[model samples]
Target: MRAIWKGAVSFGLVSVPVKLYSATENKDISFRQVHAKDGGRIKYQRVCSLDGEEVAYADIAKGYETEDGEMVILDDSDMADLPATSSREISVEKFVPSEQIDPMLFEKSYYLEPEKVGAKPYALLRKALEESDRMALVTVSLRNRMSLAVLRVREDVIVMQTMMWPDEIRNPDFGAVDVEDAKPAEVKMANMLVETLAGDFDPDEFEDDYREAVEALVKAKIEGGEIKAAPTPAKTGGEVVDLLAALQRSVDAAKTARGESSAEEPVQTSSPSKGTPRKTAKKTATGASAAPRATKKASVKKAPAKTAKKTAKKAS
Candidate 1:
């Protein structure tokens, strides 16, 4: 894999020169906007409201909008003059227990490979983190913004996981969910369901079914066959009022589906996080299986610079 960014992992006075490569990838069968009738690619123009003319790519500078709708245009030179904490260094602030970092704060992960001269220091930091079981909290500037990231050893190599700012995480205070009642029996049965379904998180076991189906559909269409609708999961019976019964049935069903014994043994109930919103599945014409895929697609967006993207563009 090609390196996305070239930088140094600041270890005190020592700088470990490293190349950063994306540690994760989203495999989605994406389609660009195109004209339906002519099958031509749709393009967007950067039109300026001040003048009725299209802005050239290089001429397009960023503009910060004020509350009263005034645009403050910032050119490359102006942005360059702004202070950067560390433009080309992953400056380690401190090391903290790995578990202390919230998984929700994690945004993107990158694999750090040592440059020829920095290999020894790189290995030293990696060994230290492994021995202490701690992750180094570091600040790195990219795309004109500084992001909080953690450096941890994955196998022998150091991996950096960027995080969202604390303020970025929303206060999930939905009043409706706060008032939802839970019975002891329902809670007990739900925990049992969790226990039965809780196995190793082997990502390889799950397939990108939607992407595979899209590929199959394309192939079938090319071969002069009818495009088959995506496989819809079998619809279950409607929701029952008895919460305990529903949980028990769900546990049994999941066990049966996994080819395990449908036995209802004593189980410890884990109370859901206080005030956390529960996702209630709704029956639809298509299936709920598409929801996860749609979420991934929704995350796809474009951006600007300070001036670079840490992630690579989708390879054609």
Candidate 2:
């Protein structure tokens, strides 16, 4: 597992240099938009709504649509002036009881591996958090943005999980979901039902039935000699020749379209081999009190033709 970000964890006068690796991934199978009659991928162009003409990638600039319906176009210089931090220190703000943290705030999880010289201090910090039964609230800069995260010990390893700002969590307005309480007999029966089903959670016991079924169906189709060969997507005028260059252009174009290059949440880094996230450590620490919800995972935005085709479809 290659390190995506290199930084140091600092608390009081102690500093532990560590490498950060994403601790989670998405396994959802993806499909693409295509011509059903033929094996060709559908493509899209960046056309202006008003002019109705395709726009060049170089001509694109970030635009912010105000609440009053005004478009505030911003150039590269404008975006450059926006406040961004790239600090390499994971500064600990305070140690708080683990239970105090709301699981809803967790956005992403990462593992921290100590540098050779900082091994002792890293273990000390992990042991301290475990002994105190607390989590170290920290501020770290990742991808040129400062974020709130927590450092806690999970199975003798220190894990850093980024958090969302309070305002980002919308308050539910269900208009008082209050209802009458159940009768004593009904409540007793409900408790009995709960006791009947109660058991320790072993993650291995559960499986992604939907994903497994899809895989099996695809395998059966392949065995039956059913397949379509998607033609290579044709490149437009002045397209980048190199794959890496094209990918970088797609990333930059996506950032420009969003009007916000700053990632609110940390995203996974590509692995050295198959592009999937990898772990070199013996095991991962995912049994922390504030386990990140699968729904909140974030991915780095990319906009290649194939990816854009997939993006146009409703997510699985």
Candidate 3:
């Protein structure tokens, strides 16, 4: 893949030339809006609110709305005059353990590949990070916006992940949970249920069932098949009157579904039945068994053979 950005990794006086490339992809089906009668594509135009006419791209300008609906327009030169502290260089500030960073702070990830003769330094940095068990905290700017980022070893290569600002997160302010004063027995049962359902994380075991069903429905529609919506399964009624009994029933159901019981499940094998003719096995006088040979049947002649026989008798 082509690199999206080319820049140097700067820390102290050291600078390593590197290139950044996207690491992920989206695989979603897309549709377009069209005129239903004519099947023509629809188009949109940008019009000014005051004049009610289509506006040209050159006539547009960036503006900020302030108090009292006042507008403050910013020209290209005005934006260019902003601080250039985070313009070109990735300035490393400090190093911290990778686990110390919260997953919510990450915004986007890009693969960093060393350019030209920078391989030694890149490998050195990767090895150093692997040894230190830490990630380098750095800042970089793109599209006139500076963002905090983390640089760390992803296997043998380095990756840079942009982070969001702290203030971007909203505080959780639920007034109060109505069921805060839950009964002791309910809490105990809930804990027991949680313990029973707890399992190791396995991403492969999970599936997008809704997406699969939707795709299947699309395929059926494309094939001109009659579509009938399936009814949603009704949930089991009523709360558990006996928590221990419900838990035991769930555990028993799971075990049965997994076929984990020790009673020796029936082995399934395919073999020719007694009704089907089989090759005869040979047994020698010395009790040594010999491999069986396959038998072949003779083909019967039809009306042509009878005609040939009549012609032969007439000739005789």
- Deviation from native of the Cα of residue 303 in model 2, angstroms: 23
Q: Please name the candidate that would achieve the greatest TM-score relative to the true structure.
A: 2
**lDDT by residue for model 1 (1-316), tens:** 9997888999689899999999999887898654343233443445555443445688878899999998899998898898765498899999999899989999999999999999899989999999999999999987657889999988788999999999999887865564248888888999999999999888899998999999988888879954333334335542331233334445554565567886433242443355632221221221223332222222222223211122221110
Can you give the TM-score per candidate against the true fold? 0.63, 0.73, 0.61
Better of 1 and 3 by lDDT: 1
The C-alpha lDDT values of all candidates are 0.68, 0.71, 0.63
Q: Locate the minimum summed-lDDT window of 10 residues in model 3.
A: 291-300
The sequence of per-residue lDDT tens digits that candidate 2 reaches over residues 1-316 is: 7889998999999999999998998999998765564444554456566644447789999999999999999998998999999899999999999999999999999999999999999999999998999999999998899999999888788999999998999998878775467688998899999999999999999999999999999999999988865434334333332333334334544665566573322233433455422321101211110111111111222223455444323221
User: Which model is ahead, 1 or 2, in terms of lDDT?
Assistant: 2
Ranking by TM-score: 2, 1, 3
Candidate 1 is scored at a TM of 0.63
**The CA-based lDDT of model 2 is what?**
0.71
In model 1, which regions exceed 4 Å deviation?
49-53, 57-59, 143-145, 176-180, 225-316
